[model samples]
Target: MGDGKSSPNPSSDGEEEVRREMPAKKKVVVVMGATGAGKSKLAIDLASYLPCPIEIVNADSMQVYQGLDVLTNKVPLSERQGVPHHLLGTVAASEEFTSKDFRDLAIAIIDDILARDRVPVIVGGTNYYIQALVSPFLVDDVVDDITACSLNSSRELKSVDSCAGYERLKEIDPVAANRIHPNDHRKINRYLSLYESSGVPPSSLFQGEAAKKWGRADCLRYDCCFIWVDAALPVLDRFVDQRVDCMIAGGLLNEVHEIYKPNADYTRGLRQAIGVREFEEFFRYYFSNTMADGTCVCGNCSAYNSEDGTPSSINEYEEALEPNFLEILNSNDNNLKVLLCESIDKLKANTRKLVRRQKRRLNQLKKYFGWDLHNVDATEALLSMPCCLL
Candidate 1:
């Protein structure tokens, strides 16, 4: 009887060991919210709560690029509380890091973390990045290699007239044409490019099971827990404005100044960052009018050459002008001052609008994709947290 009981115990222990060895579904935590909602802080704080180690994969499109740290609002290393952050400021500033790029890179990172028995915390305000990561379906997935390069090339699309592009899309895929606004040249171009590239109708990608389930919760590539750190619109708006002001105080101008170019493409790369383009007019005017000696060439300002003497060469003058650019903000020139003020105002306004748009998109994701988002209201925290904490 004792021998038989010991044999049964051995079998039970083997079953338990097998159960322990079985692979569990990988879990990923996504912390998403509007800009300035403390998503970074919350994601870092999660490390203390979870049983496993956590690594962060940044999903912010702009934050992926190197430089412009203040303008992009990237979480500083010290503020990260020693959490290993992946894909943060890793891309070249000149390169366009698209949603597809993010999805591919982030999945690899998340999988590696899971393989090591750690959770990946994806934190960012970029909704499309988050969507692409969790959903397997992407527009690029359908495109073949031959024409894929031309799919979203603004230069290639620019050559095609908007009306003609829409007409071409209508001819190739009328269902797609009717779904998008006629004036939405970008989408029109995308559809036409998709059809031309893959030799398939753009509308066909969404059919039957694919149409019903693509990007929905049932199609999620991984088990995900979504945390949306939200706040009241009024409170969020106020916080965003304050944050912008803080950013400016913290060397945002100098950062933007370093990247300013005469005809930089604002549609791509780090130049697409909000504060960069807004300051274009101010920088253009500043560089064009200010002399090497820091004298304003504008008719309204007095012409006072540098005490060190005017630069003998145009290049030398150009090099000397930058040091005095900030001082020009305090100069008596009303136009320069107005331009600077307007740019700052525009940055604030645009950021506020982005907050609303992000909130709406988050709501749409929940309503349409059946995302079970856990909302944590940070209104009180935003209202009460000191500037240093924020």
Candidate 2:
């Protein structure tokens, strides 16, 4: 993420001479929301209130890619107000950011902050990204085999990509295939290692509804007090529209263009976060001097939904003033849910609710995302939840 390492610990001579001090560690606070929800803004403001200098551990999915200052709506440096942020714009376009990578990196940053008596505030709207930091979701290689990993390099295994991994998982553990993120190479490789080393699939071992790891209801640790910002859907949609407008106005197009020209790894890989694909449409459809709207004309676009937009990014994004975004947004995840925006407002509302609910559950579990699930969704109502959201 952010290559910004915490500076070396200063000699305690000056401060230590004054008083005997207790070893105090950093406390972490996470601000979470959905796309278009105000997460970074809140995190930035909250930094000023921490007991020590805040080292922001960014958890947004898109912000890690370098040079994407505008498209991912990279938090402006001025807005940071000088509070040092970790992991905002660090990785190049060619590199990939994985949850396991995030976990290892974050633990280091958090520990560094604690050693320096600072607070670490982890913030972002990407739910999974935040979970990677605070949760107990283990990503260890299949305990059954140690030699398997040693035999293969991470790049060699990861090169298989999620597609091949998914196919393999289906043969080994079909149930897990349904749940694992299609793009999650880490998990896939882990599963692949399991199959290659051990004879059975991981899902078969965890083959029960009681398998809490696969459950979606879990999120936060058991001791967290959760608060969620609530707003009506229509209002949030308006906010999303305005936010996207601001990104476009703030030179997001240029940032995307710069990255696109480089054809770097991140640009083609993770940089496809959100708006990058939309602008690709703009480049194609109105490449010449055509005074038209710079909106996505993909399949779901009102224009494509109405008639004109096409699929090819080079054609739709490059030629037009507005990139054809409908097709890009309408793409689906493994569950067939559209990866793109259905409604910005609904996305903001539901995802925020999801985060709030997760934090509440985590507080109950006593470990972030570590809870005893009896494997029933409706059963959640039976437990008396703490009064924190108010």
Candidate 3:
């Protein structure tokens, strides 16, 4: 929805003048938490009662891509009410929208909101995008391998000898090598390239740039208020289960089929969404195991293929199959039930993992910008006005 411009009335000339002279503080509200933690709902609720108009800027990476609204857990139109939302489902599913892209777009949108005298509410679970917007992406943070190379083409950077490269980096840029895990060949390559292109080490570049910028490595690029909406793990787990069930009922599998293609670009873009990849295996198995009319052809029908095409014969995948896997597959109703249950469990597990990672990111954010953070229990916050100051 487009933002509604508030026109001034001559009758309220005094109030308008005061507002124009002393505009509201230009700060953005960042509601961050795990999936199914009700971050979006909290933003809508807060905006509903705020004295000033508020606009929601989407920060969830998946929601930016067009389609898969149900899978991405986008707020339904009926629920959004009349509040204007920006950056949700604005990009095509085929395209990739990175955190850098989000940072640029969001900054511009936030500026417009401030110009319109409306508060910008940034809400989502994608911690990286929010982090990018809040902090500056220093040039030293990203070491270009090509720029690091002295020659026209450095084949060593692209060599399969990853171990030798790690050793080489340790000899040249010991600080960079120590910061990077020995097993991480990609980072090793980047450090090696930086050394080859320039005699200086990555540590020196970072320290030099950091000293020039804010006397430290990290600095806030935007003044923001971080609201961490948190809930108990058990409560969140139940919510995750219910959300997965709802997505299934909402035809999430059909939505998956719409964009599901063999050898598709699953590593990038909307296809990387958890639901899309997790369900791809089940959908493929379901289609192949069943007939054109949905008749079961396999006896137990318990065996299923994973994303890697490895067959698992039980509720969980194991190197050794159960002795009665064949017998179980032959079972009538129980076989189908088990397969469906396993698929659902996989979805729940993946979602839970995502939430755990997001929660951990909170600690990092708190450490980086602790003074700016104000966390609240989501359940308690929902009952009362979370941000009365806004």
Candidate 4:
């Protein structure tokens, strides 16, 4: 929509008139990059440079949930500098927030901001969310009755094994089947459902020229200015390590403990966050070995409350547990210590992996979708600026 080329005029005399008459597309700035690359900071900083008021719409999948402020690295209100942020920590921790949901809400919020004469800055490392916001089509959107179709497909395939499902998908839509892993039963089932419901092969949806450039600039919903806040891998890796340590010290354990449950589902919602599942083994062992009757078994532990069995406050409860927690951490039991240390190391390692993955996906988007990303190097800032700012 913002291709920067003027429309051809029928006559030379009417060229100026046609140029003046054409309406300008609304501008939306999208700041994206790897995690810990300072996308949020850059989005906030754009407020001072852009002439109009700016509101940020978070596109990060994890940061959209209600908890794990430290784990998700959500910018604190004090650091937001009074800039309004939408869809940040607005979803229930247990609820699944999908790309469709994000696109629907972000479009509404962006429209509202544009109507108010303020620019909407989309910021996050989740490129899929940004892609959904800008692009009109989604793979799932092709089905008119996806829920009903999925139910019927599930019933029909209830008795089928994974191997059988793959064979069936290959028979009906070999192109789609070849694209995905044989182990990806969810995607296989989805393809089966789409074909069964619409009487069309799933592969047909992606066959046309229009589908080839699904998320390219020519097919965008808004005139988007994409900014990639980038940094050297070494710098990002070191920063991520320090950031994980800072998150741990900033009560990450307490947060994880609050949400920890035995045999909890870590495949969905906030539980899918990097820090949450990484400590599952540690917490399972910690609670079983150290906790008894809602109090630590360690002699150094104090009663949560003498008057009532319950804690006075959440803060006081956490404070009482902290010392006992530390004692267990320092305990002679090598197993517990190993689990705790391994979880921390895993958190850092996973975060670094996420950084690399996000960077790769960003490049893929630029290469495949023709995203004109303005790269802003942040290595200097990462070195000099406080980790909290990033």
Query: Per-residue lDDT for 174-210 in model 2, tens only?
Result: 8766544454565667677766655555666444542
Candidate 4 CA-lDDT value: 0.80
Q: lDDT of each prediction vs. the true structure? A: 0.78, 0.52, 0.67, 0.80
lDDT of 3: 0.67
The collision pairs in model 4 are none
* TM-scores of all candidate predictions against the true structure: 0.78, 0.56, 0.67, 0.79
Q: Indicate the TM-score of model 2.
A: 0.56
Task: Identify the leading candidate in terms of TM-score.
Answer: 4
The full ranking of all candidates by lDDT, starting with the best, is: 4, 1, 3, 2
Cα lDDT tens digits for candidate 1, 50-87: 99889999988889999999999888988888899999
Model 2 worst lDDT window (10 residues)? 381-390
User: Which of the two candidates, 2 or 3, achieves a greater lDDT against the reference?
Assistant: 3
Model 4 Cα lDDT, one tens digit per residue, 127-246: 778888998776557544454545454444444566688899999888767544454455566677666655678777666864865687877888999999999999999999988888
Can you tell me which runs of candidate 3 are displaced by over 4 Å?
A: 1-25, 138-208, 211-218, 290-337, 379-390
By TM-score, rank the candidates, best first: 4, 1, 3, 2
Please give the distance, in angstroms, between residue 36's alpha carbon in candidate 1 and its true position after superposition.
1.2
